[model samples]
Target: MTEKTYPKVGGRSAKITLVLLVIVYIFNFVDRQILSVLAEDIKADLN
Candidate 1:
């Protein structure tokens, strides 16, 4: 049988990845909120 090794958690790469994910999530949330707030105005303009 062979043993498989996995990368360590909380490493530098992991921290960087986590930070990037959080940033993307924040931007996505803001974008959705803005669209929701302006939906009515956008619809009225388009119609």
Candidate 2:
């Protein structure tokens, strides 16, 4: 006898997930860029 799995998880299409991930990534990149731009000034003052 073979066992069968029941009850599927709520599914989202791959495309939608990819789109959301990309948007979040872009926001993260923008934040990182701003920090990167200011990094030198902060470092110079810390030491």
**Which candidate number maximizes TM-score?**
1
Local distance difference test scores for all models: 0.96, 0.91
Candidates in order, TM-scores: namely 0.77, 0.51
| Whole-structure CA lDDT of model 1 | 0.96
* lDDT (Cα, tens digit) per residue for candidate 1, span 1-47: 99999977688888999999999999999999999999999999999
lDDT comparing candidate 2 with the true structure: 0.91
Candidate 2 lDDT over 1-47, as tens digits, reads: 99999987546786788889999999999999999999999899999
Count steric clashes of candidate 1: 0
Clash pairs, model 1 backbone:
none
RMSD of each: 3.8, 4.9
